[model samples]
Target: MRQYWINFKGNQEGPMSLEQLAQKGLDETAYVWHSGLADWVKITTVPELNDMLNNSAKAAQESPAELPEQEPEAVTEEVPELETEEVPELPQEEAIADEVPSLDNVIESPAPNYGGQQQYAMPVAPQQGPAPQEAPKCPPTNLVWSIIATVLCCSIPGIVGIVFAFLTKKYYREGNLEKAQRMSDYGAWSVIISIMLGIISMPLSCAMNIFKVAM
Candidate 1:
């Protein structure tokens, strides 16, 4: 019923109802004039125009805007199934029962008689473990001679002779025949050396005793 005039694009558009002005997309900043207005004024200053603009803004906010439609997604391709393989069956075996012999099939051997003594097959003397390693055929340690030398001659070479004699016995026991023989020779030599030293020192010792007696 009430008519309003709008300054549309710096030109007087005019004489339209509030619905026409709202449809025209005018805002509060738009200049408008009407019969009761003194000169051109903003739409925000007029109660009727301002109220219409607010109501229109509220209605626009309440409604949703339309969106552009999207294209449908591409159809997926199906995968082909693989071929199945056939397995060969195994052959079955027939079960066999154990065969036992009767007493008629068995042959008995006659036992040997030894003057009625029930001889148990003398347990084959546990194969005598390689004949006890036959004590290595080595030379005798000259221990007695070494001891004799130690007691009757110079102590130094005599003691060495005794040591060699013991080493000969030790090497012989350890299965070292060559070392045992060598130590035996060493013992003999040491004994000989001791006897020779004792012989050489005897006259000197006697002469010294004689000299002391004379002095």
Candidate 2:
């Protein structure tokens, strides 16, 4: 007796006679190998195995009718099958009908108007970004006034004012509005402070000279 080997699901599980192989009830999809085979092929691909499957199928069909009575077989032969058209199963049709309700019972959403004078789409509001912070108004630079104060009033304070006047422009360009404004205020206030001091120091001396000349 010839022996065959079978592989199933990545496990090799046979080196048996055909009877032993048939006992395992393997499907034709199982791979079988025997001597002279190049590689294992599906049992269905082999002609011998194909006939074996067909024979088994015929055996299965005959098993139910294998009762020891010739009379039932004679009766079956004598009886003629009626030619009847098969109507569709009612339950399946009813199931489909239930799934999809009639249009009469369906609630519909309002349809869009496609007729004359199509209305324009509503304008969308522009996306607003963060509002820009307004730059603080820079005070007077006081550059010319600082120079005059340096000559007539106080040298140090007037020079300091001139320095800040120059800084104001630089700070403003660099987006430091706060620093620019402070520099501008410092420059203007320096000139005012110098004027006040000059008046306080010379006011009395000038008045005395004027009174003496008037006499």
Candidate 3:
């Protein structure tokens, strides 16, 4: 009977007999055959066996020494060179050093205007502006709606809405318009749901009220 070393779900569990391994969902393809260890070695999940085989095959193909034969080296004979003519030399001038031009003497030409209009010299912009920046606009407050929602949220659903509304208010005060809007939406939806549930329960509550009235 064949022996196998099973590696399953990141755990190295067994060196069980092949029959035992098979009972645990092990198969010939699931594990690699290792002649040196005289056992089948499992690497990954059973379904990944084909991928492992392809990877192994690719690794074997990429190995260097398995390449084909080279062509024979060619022999070449050296040829002799012919003699060339000599060239004549020209005379060089002696250096006369003159005083360098002063910064004031150095003239700069005005930049040519590519456009038809005469180009006005551009003034450097100030690094800091004196203008006072306008403060960011505050989000619109729905105080009445907020109070109504908060009162309705006395129950579980209403409480959730009130929590969201509080969060929205806090974010709005902090100048986080986006987060405030999101929280407000949550509060609004929760308030609507809670109101709907309360309205639905009113009929049953009214029946109980009628029974008490009759008694």
Candidate 4:
């Protein structure tokens, strides 16, 4: 029997009988040569190595090197919480003010009432009780005019105008309409008198100054 030899790991690993080579288990793609063979051939081609090749292939299939499939990395998601906003309550007084009717709402009457008779043609005014007396309108104290009169005209009437102006506002606030009106008239008269005096005195004052300068 010719002894078989095989190369492994880049060197001659065996020079044994075929039976011994088979027992040792040849690689599936191992190269083998013998005294009769022309060149090295696959160990599997040899009938003797077939059992070893089958056993190796079965072992490899049973214990594969690939890692077990990983369950798709557990996907974890964080859901954010939403915040709630609160509305503030309005005060009773302000709420009541909003509910109150507007002043301009009471007095407006757009269309006149129509009647067939000429005598009834005049629109009857809405019935209402005698209206409360309106507060009196105060006249200006003529303070500006009073100051002008005092500076450029006679001082006596200007001072009186300013005094009457002050009295006009005071009497009106006190509900003394007659007195307030009287004060208003007097104030105007005082300012007029002061202006007339100032005009008349202006020429006299200039003339007197000129006469003194000549002297």
Q: Model 2: what TM-score?
A: 0.33
List model 1 lDDT by residue over 21-66, tens digit each.
8689876546565443223444565555555676667666664432
Candidate 3's C-alpha runs over 4 A off are: 1-143, 149-154, 211-215
Worst 10 residues of 1 by lDDT: 87-96
Expressed as tens digits, the lDDT of each residue in 1-215 for candidate 4 is 33556643233444576446646655653545443222333455444344445545565566554312211111111011011111111221232235422312222322222222322211112112111112124666777888887777788998888889888877765545568789989989998998887778889999999999999
Model 3's lDDT to the true fold? 0.39
TM-score of 3: 0.30
| Model 3, span 1-215: residue lDDT tens | 22234443222334454335434543222333211221222323222233334334544567554322110110010011011101000000000012212211111222122221211211111002110110223333444454565575336767777678678767755545567788878777777777777788788789999999999
By how many angstroms RMSD does model 4 differ from the true structure?
50.9
Q: What is candidate 1's TM-score against the reference?
A: 0.37
Q: How well does each candidate superpose onto the true structure, as a TM-score?
A: 0.37, 0.33, 0.30, 0.37
Off by over 4 Å in 2: 1-138, 205-215
How high a TM-score does candidate 4 get?
Answer: 0.37
User: C-alpha displacement of 120 in model 3, angstroms?
Assistant: 28
Worst 10-residue lDDT window for candidate 3 reads 87-96
RMSD list, candidates in order: 55.1, 37.6, 31.0, 50.9
